[model samples]
Target: MDHGRPKPDLIIFDCDGVLVDSELLSCRCLSEVLAEFGLQLSVEQALELFLGRSTKAIEQYYRDLLGQALPDDFLARLRARVLETFAEALQPIPGAGAVLSKLQTPRCVASSSDLDRVSLSLDVTGLAPHFGDRLYTAQMVRHGKPAPDLFLHAAGRMQADPARTLVIEDSVSGVQAARAAGMMVWGFVGGAHYRARDGRAILSAAGADRVFAHMSDFWEA
Candidate 1:
């Protein structure tokens, strides 16, 4: 542990943009699927509206925005599309492997994605070995990001105190959730989706304790 600064007893990670460069790809696919329902959005817009959110929450946002519920099979179709796309396109965040390999403290993944998506992402990116079975997902909790439930759940399961845990996230919702969980947060901006976005400002405004633009910084932090 780096004792020069406040070292956390546990380190929590968000999946999509933090561990994998899947945000842009996911947004692209989501935008395409949303168009089927007469809801049109560009990839960037989709990322802005739905990044770090669960599929359920994404559906709710669309429903709330359009004032109508999606078709019964809409999410099913969307999920299938996502799975296929991920199987072909998913990649890990640059330098993420090095950081994960070098980390000395306890670490785990807590993501808004379901277990299948998380597992597939890790497997596709060749990062599964680094995480093993230390995966947490929104499906495991009653609430998702922006609610603090998943992070708290992961910390509790890991036997780490909330106040002593650190979270690395790449989205506003994830940052808010970490803060709500009483954990220190670092906003990550190294994913492809963040290159044209001021993810630092967005996440910091949402209460992240620090902002880092690369996975290399994770090792230093």
Candidate 2:
């Protein structure tokens, strides 16, 4: 614990990269789908552009780049493919369950993914019972990560003072959102998606108060 700051009353967790190790899988699926549409993005490029963003971001990106809406079935196809892959490969972040089981602070998931997607992720990874109905998604708010809206909404719902809240996230946008919400934020770089990246530096630059590479170091960091 960082003795300087008050202990958090509530811990807000980001679902995709932070809770479930689904970032790489998601980006890869996205790349494949986009390629079918003649959009040639590698998994790395997809992660660079859409990590921590919602499906709305995908729609906007398609429109911005092609000057037209994505094919009407784009989201449906993407969702089906991603979910199919997730069912076969998704796993909770290492130590996530152990940490959650022992954590004393009140916590909930706040994700940029859609409600159905986030819910399914938790369910598939055996993290659903830990959160129950406490999952909050971008679809619930007008803005998602990097906007402060989602975090603020979660804090309000959890009745936690933002200044005393701690957010565990893995994306730059998520770190920025937590800071913008006036909360303490820790960047987690344990997911497979971060294998070759300097996540500590990237997240620190995005205003995370602390950055750690594994959930085993969560409290110690």
Candidate 3:
């Protein structure tokens, strides 16, 4: 179909699963925290419930699971653990660097994760130089993914036309947010979150223009 010709002026990438292989890190972090409460959660369960959500949502999940609020230091401890884990292993997705280097248009990263986590992930993956000051964290926006606020805020900051922007995402909520912001949506299916039938179907039904199984397949579309 020669889908490469109609290139957009800006490309927004999700940070976790799209740029770095942090889905497992996320699952492990959550599992470890929940396990301290005597609750066991599988990676698959964590991926299904927690991927693409904010830290607050995750904290609340823990609170709900334990029937009590997490300690005030819970977030800080979790952040430290996740940062330490990611620092040791923040491998970039294959072909991501090549694709970023080849992109002629302006590019930025808009992630549902907080600024600190986003910065750490990008830095560890060596993608920090490519993004520069173009990193937009969802915490700055009124709402997170599935709300379109974050994507719209990012487009505004970049001064890029939403209609001419392309968003690469791995979560159904992220895809829905991009579509709501009037941008072309490309679903990246190489993440743990989309491993299930329902997750895959949800993304497709959310109106992703295309789904990519790998970064190499992204150029094909």
Tens-place lDDT per residue, model 2, 4-54, is 798899999999999999999999999998789887889998889899999
Among the numbered candidates, top lDDT falls to 2
- The C-alpha TM-scores of every prediction are 0.95, 0.97, 0.89
Model 3 poorest 10 in a row by lDDT = 191-200
Rank by lDDT, descending? 2, 1, 3
Instruction: Report lDDT per candidate.
Output: 0.88, 0.91, 0.82
Best-first order by TM-score: 2, 1, 3
Judge candidate 3 against the unseen true structure and give its global Cα lDDT, from 0 to 1.
Answer: 0.82
RMSD of 3: 2.5
Please report the candidate that would top TM-score against the real structure: 2
Q: Please count the clashing residue pairs in each candidate, in the order shown.
A: 0, 0, 0
lDDT of 1: 0.88
lDDT of 3 by residue, 19-64 (tens): 9889888888978976876668887888777777778777667677
Per-residue CA lDDT of model 1 for 1-82, tens digit only, reads 3434477999998989999999988888888887998877899788877889999898787678778787888888888888
